[model samples]
Target: MDERDGKHQDAAQPEFRPYHHPAAGWGAAKSVTEFLVRERELVNGPRAIMKMNHENGGFDCPGCAWPDDTKGLHLDICENGIKHVTWEMTRKRVDREFFAAHPVAELAEWSDFDLEDQGRLTEPMRYDPASDHYVPISWAEAFALVGRTLQELDSPDQAAFYTSGRLGNEATFLYQLMAREFGTNNLPDCSNMCHEASGRALQASLGTGKGTVDLKDWEMTDALFILGVNAASNAPRMLTALAEAYRRGAQIVHINPLVEAASTRTIIPHEFARMATFRPTRTGTLNLQPRIGGDMALVRGMAKAVLEEQKSDPKALDVEFIERHTAGFAEYRALCEATSWDEIERQSGVGRAEILTAARVYCEADRSIVSWCLGVTQHEHGVDTVREIVNLLLMRGNLGREGAGPSPVRGHSNVQGNRTCGIDHRPDEAFLQRLAGVCDIDPPRAHGLDTVGTVEAMHRGDVKVFVGMGGNFALAAPDTPYTSAALRKCLLTVHVSTKLNRSHLVHGRQALILPCLGRTEKDHQRGSLQATSVEDSMSMVHLSVGMKRPASPHLLSEPAIIAGMARAALPGSNTPWEKYVEDYDRIRDTMAQVLDGFEDFNRRVRLPLGFRLRQPARELVFRTPSGRAEFSTAALPDVVPVAGTLALGTMRSHDQWNTTIYSDNDRYRGIKNLRTLVFMNADDMRDRGIRRFDDVDITSTARDGSTRTLRRYKAIPYDIPRGCAAGYMPEMNVLCAIGDYSTQSDQPLMKHLKVTVEASQPAG
Candidate 1:
């Protein structure tokens, strides 16, 4: 009955191979070629549309959160950007005929690629349970049905509103406002799953929850520690910054369990010779492969080395900065000095000599920056791990200085912006008060459910209505079967999106898909072509205006969709919902009054590259209770696994971004046509009687003594550390249990998993 049964996909065995090359050479060329082929029908539209992308008049690339160098900007978009734009600007359409030809049950059997590749959704569709097919529905009826279902909820708490990173700042503001007006704070967003820990940790230590350094700081740093992130596959444009740092004699170190191609070498396509020959530029000066979940200990070992070095040279440490600007250094220094090398080595799986080598580089550097992604924040102790990284930077007087600070590299395009616009369950009281003052409604003071809590609430029948601004929740969330069941239990589920996704198939009793305009299309409302905005990883807000015509004349912009639903649902509410939809500037003006750093929001966003939001830590001011940077004393996590178990980590493929799988091949790792493949160390594979391409059954053990098994996954030998395995998510997400998450931040432990892999019998 579910789409995952996959009856429509080709049952033939998938192809697999080892890719052998650094990133951004021939592989990037292939991506461009693929984009050309995919968008052949609307060829000039893509090229003309791209000219506006990341420019003053064009839209921001709806890909990564990496900032654009607007001062010296070219097209400035990468292959990934092209693919995203091309995919959005494709000529294909899913009209009434397409829906008539395919039932919901049949569409469920299609793969993720097939579902999205069917083309842009041209009209609204409602699930007809009796027919098992989606029937065309007018926007008015769809909005009215959603409103009726929501109004019928036993209590406001029975509704959960989910927001994704793709939503524009204006839409996010309206979405959260509508939820608050509805009297519930269940504004769980994608950030709750990815970087909630980063926000929690950074806010505790630095007064501000966001990263302090901007794009310009990359040039001034003397050393960089890139941890737990596969920069090449995730943020291809970031490699340019890394390459520039290395070129300028900055020591670059990559700390990851697997050797990512971009960390080793990358070719900047903007450079002529490399673009012609696909030759690579060297990146990482040191590549450290510590045991899975050992980042805290590894960082502690580095800190201990710094302390030892300072013993001989007291001036080696930033005495003035530490004594004046930070707290808890005395106790922290004592703990580091007293720490045993054996314990550090055992916990980190790193030798003392190697630790000292990296520490020495840090000691010699004038300024340093530490950047990390989900790898460091997807552990049970994610908050503690990030805190230790902050401790390391504080030891060197790195904060508030040029080229030195902590940057939690966000994966999504506007996830940070979504948080800025109040798409959070735990809203700060001051922000709520501002919203109340602006909207004349009593904002809910009680904290609401996060992603995990939302799922649990849905399962318990406490939440009956589910509304997703964007994103495929069923496929992106952990514990797939559980999450899917929660969605099915809902009285109504709605998704505002550009194309069909798996989440549409995993429906509730009643489901609605309201197709919307993508970032590549113009959004003309209030008799004007409105522009939307997004915040980059560095907290820089910029305007993004779509150039091409909308794929469908019927598709509504997200703000328009939210307005229709809001007016219908909150009939008595007095907020100017139509005004926001008519002119996005009104929403920005409201944000300027409501949010702390968004003063003059409309004026600033109209600039060529927008403006940077205020970051207090940028000026050495700590927003903590102590009025100074506070050091954390979290101990290393206890991560010992059961005997014969391998630590499993889930990651995205080269051809994927977040949950959107562009292709089956991870070209950087040399994988092709096999998303069900697992990467394992050769020694570990041999020890377990497993070989490359061997059929395996992988079981993930939950803390509650339960397990979920994935069958018929083929194991591939790779350069990963021993006793560690890597697999693509959504396919592997089912193995993760619902209760598996960080205790402090409530973020899922997506990267750290306990699993046992065994050889399985092949098909008869």
Candidate 2:
């Protein structure tokens, strides 16, 4: 093994202790302080930057996609938000000197955390295979190289453009426009891996794909059903809303295989009175632990219970709304009625009594909200599960009303906005016509490759040039080994990134690292300070203007980088690429003309809390082919458990963001200094003759009859349901095959890996 590989090694032995404390108290504060100091931002840290996060006219946090509070409360940041800001505002630099000292091979051996911890990239760098290192390249040279390589491709389809949620609306608009004009719709993004199922299912059911509820709905809702989400870590800012709702006598039901600490209790750090008194509020009134891949059956069971109660009292369901606003209810109701209790129990791994209890809660509430994250989307039956959730909400007349709807909690700050700005592989025909009329370019009509399709295309040698707008694609994608191999097959790869990550190391024969300005960094173009816009999970669009100076003078904004590449690659195009870069308003102006719901983009975006895009489903307007919200009759997933394997789900740790590890600890789960530990049920571990902290090898078989293994992962007994196991992502992502994706949405089933575990021998 290389010596550099050992630099950020995990603890020699893992430590396990049950953490009984509420989420987000002194513990969260301490973690935030430690990260600020470690990133060298302590003295001039969170107090200054956090004040601007999610505030009016300030930069939106590059964290989760939770909407900003309408009241604009002071210190509108969470612990994870603080970590994200400090991590971006670090003083460390990964300049030419650092690359000169470390070869690409050696850096490849370093952990993901260490690579990003090296700090921000200072300038453009290109891979020199002869020297086995990256050397600095001028911006003009970089642009010329990218253009020359792209122009040389036999077909425009030979290139693929990927986007990350970190980009703002203006940049994403230019990015998609550039790619479509360049003649391909091969725009795969982070959404393909996480919430594609949500969008696909929601769009099918309700004409629109976005959530219907906003932050204010949380205050008025009588019941909140949080499904398959780990709120404490993934969306910490959401805890304040949950706590407030709990305090106001709202019924909160948490349904997941694992009993997450944050779902049970929490103390909002910003609430001075509660923080000082250490009074923890109970966030969840009921917690349900279903087997992995069992959400569809559980949701069906709840529907069945509701239907049974409806037989006794017609008021149990909003019959009037169903007849007036929805279609396919009769068939859906029949499907639920025909599903027997025994079958529901067998498939869901939940008792009928408990399912009925949850159903009763939903039936009693006049207004209800159903929210979910990756847990509900990263499954083979993810789309079906999401559709079932909508069916439950639809039964209660949840659409087009305040405090009643579906909320697919997005993780990335602007992932939802990326989609809103037209970052799609298969854009609709209306959007294309409008874009063509507005931009005077004929876009390709052919459907393009998605994330999984991009990998397949690259492997088949169809794609030659790959350009990423701002994400660690290598680590974020599933089938890590397969994705890496596919990435290497590209003729040239480019990443517009803020810091060094795993994607930089696993490169194509030729690669370019184009460092861009972070969200907290000021973007000054042509002597004018610029601001970009992003859309939150609730469809709220707002401007984000950076307050801090750029980490390096050479760093360019994402818009500038996209415009540079577009100008170089398509010199013959008539689009005003240079003008778009000079001022972002030009980009927004064009976007307003092209996109729906952004007619007055520039003026509306500058409003106090920005503007709420038109959500048709929120106003009882269904865009579906039937012109009504449709009830899904999709069958329950065949969840027959394999006798010897456990259903494992990949998750993020408390000290981590999506695909970015902040530390080797999961404080909420009571695990310390380890990222390779698998949380298993105590009975399951005992049944398998595995003890706590025992080194175990986990093997998963793909649908193609091929198997992958992760060796020597410590097995920790925890409170998860039997026949299910949980582990941190990216590490376990290797076990997820590229072919193991939702047939409906094409999202990798990262949350449903059927694996068998056995004790492994210690290394000799």
Candidate 3:
């Protein structure tokens, strides 16, 4: 690698073609083979890791939140899970010599893949502005520097603490405990960017903020509505569930602007014959392609159809359930009656025929479920759209019953678990009182900043220190340049991480990278190998015990690191930080005290396959303000873009998970060896006088007359909506301003943007 003028050596020209195969069969096999070949030096390690991954007594796959069966079945992991595992357990290492040879300035310009590809961090390191490189530092000095910086701050509010989804419940509890004890509520996390909309919307309508359905619900559902969830890429394990539902003769409907490969076909990983024949089973019996930001209108149309059907048979409308279990139904029904089909089609970009087809499927099923992902959450009307979905479910009384409810397919492994474990900026009074009673520390009451709030606060010169427990905050947050500038302006930035990322390069005046044990590595503290717990997508809390040895002797567990920092920062605190680290069960004991649903935490988590947490919404107990389920209504997103602009959708390639790029190829989308390519409709390209593979510049036109532009993106004509274009995230994240988020949830509209595309070079 060159020391100056940074550029990736592995960056390829990229070959693009139409992918015609099913989602998960031979193609998935090839991807796993490639991962194995790349990590050949890590010999027998691969076989052993695969045998234990996602099992009852094994470590959890730190990728997506899709639940595991814990059977230790044959090759129990998917292609995406294997990529995350090998990437984490790779033989490559980043030691003192590696940093000495490369400067931070040069590394900052490296590709995201290259930055992480350098390998696992081995020890604590500090940034030296004079030399433009990082140097080794003692753990004590690192902690002392951070504590002194906190002491020197005017108030704890100036310091922001961020967490990621990979952390266990115990570690997250301690991390949040430290943040609250230090008198700041700035506990921003990945959930703020991805599923905050789901939580906020559901909590307002139902009592709980979690999904009400579990894996067993798939077997009972007669029909499923999958909105904006890409099963092939984001959560491949769900495809198995979909296939099982199909075998049981369940109808599935898919709605999205971009027609994903998995939406049409799938292969169950455990079904040996299906994997061998490559004869994929159909997933979506009916697919609806709504316009960008049109999910609310589509669901509204579905509700309209449901009401119209009730005119023929009043029983079609669950009158008894609505009267006994819900509120605001009369107002919601009146609004639907007043809504026009023409208006619905105009806003949703779907004709009456397709809308009626989906409604028919919904009306015919005795038991139904609606599942969605980021595509439904990362929009201006994200929360409204989710509530509309709930409105549809209420029409049929599809909630509080077997195989019926709403499920938001979360992205990270334990994102929902993190929130349940108290990683919130706004803590409830009851939770705070319980925490204070046990920890003997006066926790902060003021609501802290979310992800966007932190970036804006830093930009306005309000924040001085940023301590990231995990995750690449710089690249993950919206408005990349602005967030990076905010990080650079900080007094100090500290990252407790297992590997290097873009967040480390966008440093403050003084920065530190504190190496920590990865999920795949054994976290042996106080002479005993410890196990952590991760709550899955279905609200199942299970034990995760690492099998592989620690990658580095110097690395510490995340809990140990957090406890050490807490001791240094709160010198006079009475909390037994070290005692909890000695045995994680003590931490669990403490959790059982402050948190609900964890009564007998140690005893329950130790059981085979662990246990499922309580979800009050599933028990016909709507804990809303009115003590009943509520229905919500909102104006349709009538966002008519300018004449020259096309609605843009930012997506993740199949090869990546979150901000980490596992490879340069995405065979699922048929783009090989490149991340700079953009997917557009062929007709849209023709209308814009652009050809396939033509290098273009995307200019994002914000409402404030301010704009952000990305250069050198090769436009590839593919299958998408006529007026919509799609590109990978972080590359397109620059175009979205941090302030341009949903009005209620404040989730960055990464999936919806107003943009105009043109040739890279002027009219030659």
Candidate 4:
């Protein structure tokens, strides 16, 4: 009866509709191809659409990192990349006799969608601890026990590695060429845990860590904004570029804390000639919401109400592009005219005429953009809330031009091409002198470890080998019982996945798992069959290849298990990891001789659908270090010592994606069945004495007083926003605290999280 089940919601709410979706966009690509043929058993439907656009193509859809719109081939997929290509072309597998019949504590109590639908794992395992399970080994004893623990580590900065932009671009350029030829730059990734505070506040305001618009910069924007992102379920084709900037007459606005229905409209249904000719599109013209960690006090009170409406209107300020291209305008206009309006309307719940009507739509936009995601880099002053949206787009003269700047929106599918093919945990000396002139050694320049300094250096034993190369890092890490006890005090962990998670049964004292190949299969190398390269979320860079074939037959190809563990750990390096896997254009000509808009990397990633990179905000160029644009110094407070508690936020569940949960449905907030639950604001859950389906326990504390909790859950009050609250994500990732992050890019502030609730168990 999934006739769009809870179709277009709002029946006094509580209506449900995800997992097997429908309300529109062509019944969401035919309810995700009928949940990929009746609940993900994907039997070759039209040979999976003729190998999803061939040319060696392996359906490049691991959800949202969106690019491919060379203004065509537009099925650029997203409802979590159609649940990551129907959960990787699922037809289920798990093999090796499903680990000789369960065990590993009964597959660590299932669910994470029944251990990823007990599928596609196939072989090469390890963790046996006397058959507690995970047997089959041999990939030459898993690269000779990972090259005898990187030649007994001692100090390659105690080995970390991490990376997980679903490793491609030739297994993250051969897993950062086996950690810079095993010398160190320890290499942490998952883009330093989600947009390293929008890449250190847009590479310190705008030299670029990437993102200065270009999805045709939302068609020459005249006003867009949209903060702390939810772009209709995390990048749903950026709701057709915010319905083409609300159909030409731009001005969209949005900001967030929850109000996402792709900001409001979107019914594409393959535009059935404008939905059987009814005509829809143009959504949000305002929206707002704010409050939970109030986006850096609501974008510095909309840049202090556009400098108090340009002090009695001096043409509402843009003073010749802030006096010829910006740089700290009079100490940020005297700290926004000595900040006050009752502390920016009680720390931004909005109203100083909605921050002076979003500062007169950014002073009547001449070209604007602003964008954001992971709700402004998951907070705690997320890089001063992304430099207060780059001080409200450099108080006019928005960095660069045509539709202005600051985009962000990245989340894998080459999470920004695994840090531009290096997998940096920090590394610059012109990318280690062009990787010491293409792998002739001498790489490490110190600085590494970032996913919270590699989980506080693996809980302080200074990490002894972990390696990931494909995430689910113990359920997208952050206090999942302290990241499964810092991955059971690692003494060698490894994963290189293709499915079967819960961090491969959270093992350690030596664990493995291998099982590679799955971008939708078929990779093959050495015998001529390669083609990788990723980079998206607008900086372009392309070429991918895999068109479904091997889900098994002993998988492989994460650049052939990182070049067979870098030819069994460096046995005298001189990298050519077998001539870049027999031609991935010699790893895109050695990642264009050590990366940076890859200097014509193999004829611009084979042109057709790749090549753009160079976005100094599309030419108006403001590479910061004083060649213009700067202005920050005015955001010195966003206080949050749980002042009368209740901030929360954490999200994900359009049948989930990150921390991959999938079905405990959240069909545009009319939840179904439930996945812990929480919501709030039904009169702030009746003035904090909460009720409707009670079962509390959310805790929080930290700043060293360590509190944390999470338990029972189930709150549900609804229409959030009064000092907000909301939940979901690796089961409320234990009410936040992987060192409650983001004091300039440590990034774990899982959408703010102040806490302080009571009743731990009531309406059972």
Candidate 5:
């Protein structure tokens, strides 16, 4: 039994058997089947919902932001996608009786998986502090309560609107519009926590925040460099593309602290012949395990090798492209030359020979693509590191062409769409002006708070009302204890969600749980089914039409709920909240008029695979102040090894999606029935006198001299860099300080936590 939540039934001694099977082959198939049976959705759920996922005129998978395959495979769903769909389509319901039987205090003690496992929320529920339980409340009453609270706030800045990436384009557009029209730009969102660094760095380097490549580029690339991204567990669909790239002999180099199993080899479940024979396809041609926060050094080393090769082979560098389309090359080249090989080897944990080998592959390739995820963007120098990657790409003239560019793979399905639809805390003057003209309202001109800023403001008593459009903000935010306490300080907290999560239990003095429809459920508006749109990682905007009946009749669509709140909050407002809710096309029409690159939104989005938003960077059109791509000259990060401490990074397990834990097992890493285990290098474990399954206390000291510790966590030895460690997030998030965020993007440095582990007890 796990003492933490008192629910897990696995053996008291955590299992650590190495998984020899290839990822997403038999293991994925079995996992999918098990989830279906567990959710009692083995029949029509998989047959119908699974087919609709990632297909034209079907609902998008509420999983990763990977672009859909235009080849239209019969089954495009991945194991995690199936898990998400089945998890949402679970038959279990959390109704009034369920809440009546359990008090909020009791529910708060339940584990995240157990709480969400209680299933879909049925109706709007309001917290009754006297009874310590949630009681059913009518939708109208809930809306009125939210409206009254917002209206009663001392200032509009006292309220912060939070958006999760799962929200669709139509709903997200309306959400931001409502917040702006209500005179507050405090629109803190999930992007602030995850990909803010990517956006900031890309916008600065290439004049565009999004990736320039589509799925088609994967097939055309000569070399693919994957950095700090674990595709198997995070975005399983990417495995298929990687396998194909491998078969086509594209040199793939995977660089990270841990050599992820999927990055080396993967079995594409959809490949019938390979699946029948159990043959795993090779993925990474070379894998580099660097120390945590050493990516900048590793990339700079590659640049140095390329520069050296340019001396001998003039073709090694695209001199003409750099001279015509880029600026600041001389400064960047000087920095690379000034940097020493000894410093690079010491910092990146990779030898000079290996760096040169990787550089040779990159230089020889006609076109190459570099892709990354949270690992690259969740560090103190995340923005600088990404800019370095852009520098490497620009040296080879990899941008503005097929099969080349920087790819920041997003985690959430519509996360990119949310930002595209104006879910930004700091909207530009042009965007705000367009929105104001389209909506016929004077929007707020002041910049709003991001996730970190919102938490700080709440703690300082500057914020009162917290409105979460979707997401488990309490658990997902860094410094879990601080965030929870900050949330409790709010006068009123509201969550518009499809299910009960930790954020619901960790509430304010007065809280409202406004239940909403999930992505798999049919959204009925004005007696007709409605479809929403989402933008994938490649900037492809496509419609998502749900087919299944809603978990409950009382659950309204996200757009409907936002409209209700807007109407109740601003009774005198002239925005057509009701009309937009009735016809989603109205939302699209207004969005096209407001946002760029959506000129023919309604008509174009209805086409076969929707439409690709115009990426100026892809067309070699730089919108930077220099009117060209800019090479960064930022100094390399200080990556010297600290005494008696290991750099730790938090990651999700195979059976997890963001903050939602599906199970305790991490299939790819071979961690079973446990989430509190810290993975350490064998050498480090031996040196520290810590054995496998030993209970160890991991502690981190914040810059403010405060310390956070995770007590009695099992320490497991694994294949990783000597001075680097890995652990599951949200559990390890406690060790991250609230102020420990990237200086440039304000994204929490979840991937560069400095921690020390001390043995608490030997394996029992």
Candidate 6:
């Protein structure tokens, strides 16, 4: 092999090290300047960053809230986040000429990263079959067409409105309003794909859809159970809290199939080279690597261990809290006692000793917190897994404590906020009743379609029109081939976004692209500047103001886009849609009138750092139907390995944010330039007769006669558990079938799939 090929092959090898991963937000050198040049279109680079930070104050970096040294006003965005910011602020324009030069068919073959890197969509465009290109259309014409399509639908259910968590509260509220005003409550946000399982489990157990702990709660917690999450890369700001927890003698236990860097020591750049270069920041006290799709088993083992320990020493559990505040403990205890340790050990890949040790630590701690992200929620039995985790916490009376509760590490800045502000498929009766009062129109009481339901409807031709508020639907979904085919069945598709993405290429017959304002841009409505609110994972609501100017004068705010669409869809509807757009407070006032937590939305949201929503459970108040906390006992046995098969997980690259790709570089894995590859255990690779750098094919055994195969991927061996493998999603989505989704939450189980792999034919 040549030097370049040899270097690439060498870099592809997996090196299992024990150091903390690179800083995700603030540690990358030149991240700010690079962002200014690429995302902000500032010719003066660092000068632009300085000006924005001083006078306008650069908007919260449009990145993860991994804490920065705000005292020193240093920029704290990560490598990927910098790329995300720069990508959004990019001057690269995908105008009519760009479209005219490339047909939709040709663009479809381009990688997801390449398609988005071309830059922002500058004008409204509609797909034309004859020309095979998206031709620019007049705004008036586009809105009229959208109205006509929605109006022609046989029923409101025939069309669906989808929202992404990345959207601001103002935009999400307006988008939901448009759907409700159009006579359908079919509003499903991106949460339907990621954390719906967490919401379901938490709401059923505690009567709250969000986490019971706030950011301040960390200060009081004695121990933290970081389950199925990689906070180091996904949310680096969390490391600061964890580091503090370590310094305070709070034990942190990390559970995941991957031995991520965050579970080790990290260098804090903001702390200066004094500690950064010499000493690594301690992140976790214990690290456990369970098998893929084995979270349920691991959690069950933990609960079982807790129960067994409590039997020997009654003081091991919080008997007072359990007797006073919980129900169904007897049945749950019986189930745990009957569960076999051999089964748990086989599935979790962790011995009884390890589980008992973790359980003892949790029991001894006055306050213990459990936090998980997509890892625990993106499985066939994700809901049960979360329910079991709650069971473990409840056994020790951890619910509603200062540092003890379940925390779902949410994706996207405003995903949780989107759900908070009425972007739900199944709105509760109380929330719906309040919403009806706001608009003076009775909203739909029946449940609406979720992300999977919407896709299925489109596939069955039951849905004719699809409207996306912000996310790239085609790219975020599993089974890319099936999802693309489903999109083709829709008669009309509308995408309101800031940049050009792959979803735009997989279009309906009459697809309309609506360009909207980015979070980094100043939002001007009527005569005043507007600010939007985003709810973090801790239920802390904060106000975000844009510093950069609009990428284009023609660009409209998401709220305005929804209002314009509403005007067209319902001509002469007496609702003051235009008035609400002019003033967002009026919108917040209406929202507050309908939602219980925001009694003083306008005044409360104006605070320097927004107000926290009222959460009774944070103080240990149970609002369940029984007026007590509930415990569920369901033990997940190991997935019996077939004669020849493995559990594969679909993941995102470090250079990627959801479906948007910044580059092919995955710095943590030492991967750069290329992304089409899978990471597998070295033993598994050898046993399957697959060699390193060998082109391999992964085929999914669909229940139907059809088979989906992802071809020509290089296999890179790593230190993963046996029977566990991982490949990047959107590309390997083809392996996931249409019906292969979680039954309870309807979220796609993209993280867990059964597949067979073999060598692919060499390129002729």
Error of 3 at 760 (Å): 2.2
Clashing pairs in 1: 3-108, 19-670, 59-545, 207-623
**What is the overall TM-score of model 6 with all chains considered together?**
0.93
Q: Tens-digit lDDT track for model 6 on 1-764? A: 00001112123443332233444424354444555655655553343344322213345445553322323445443455555666777778888899999999899766666777788778888999999999988888888999999888899889999988778776777777778877787887788889999988888887788888776667679989888777766776676678778888999999988877677766555566534355555878998878887777777878887777776888878889989888999999888778788888887877888887887788778888888998888887888888888888888888766677877788677788889888998888887777777687667878889988888888999988999988899878766766778888999999998877878888888899999988778889986888777777777666667767787777888888888889889895777888989988888888788767877888887665567888876677777898777888665745645657778888776667777766566666656566677788888889888988787877767545466777777788876888888877667776777778888778887888877777887667
What C-alpha lDDT does candidate 2 achieve relative to the native structure?
0.90
Worst 10 residues of 4 by lDDT: 1-10
Which pairs, if any, clash in model 4?
Answer: 25-269, 26-269, 56-546, 57-546, 57-547, 58-546, 58-547, 93-119, 103-106
Indicate the worst ten consecutive residues by lDDT in candidate 2: 1-10
TM accuracy, model 1: 0.97
lDDT of each: 0.86, 0.90, 0.87, 0.73, 0.90, 0.76
Q: Which RMSD does model 4 reach against the true structure?
A: 23.6
What is the clash count for each candidate, in the order shown? 4, 0, 0, 9, 0, 10
Look at candidate 4 and tell me the lDDT of residue 750.
79
Candidate 3 lDDT tens digits, 542-571:
888887787889999999999988888999
The sequence of per-residue lDDT tens digits that candidate 5 reaches over residues 1-764 is 01131124355656898777777888888888888888888785666645565555588988998888898787887999888888888888999999999999998878888898889999999999999999999999999998999999889999999999999999999999999989999998999988999999999998899989999998899999999999998888899899999999899999988888778788888888999999999988999888898898999999999999988999999999999999999999999999999999988888999899999999999999999998899988999999999999999999988999998999999999999999999999999999989899899999999999999999998999999988999999999888999999999999998888999988899999999998888888889889999999999999999878899989899999999999989999999998999999999999999999998899999988899999999999998999999999988878765888999999998889988999999988988889888999999999999989888888887777778888788888998988889998878888899988888899988998888888975445
Better of 1 and 3 by lDDT: 3
lDDT of 4: 0.73
Q: For model 6, name the residue pairs that clash.
A: 24-78, 25-77, 25-78, 39-86, 39-89, 66-237, 67-237, 266-281, 479-733, 480-733
Model 6 vs truth, CA RMSD? 3.9
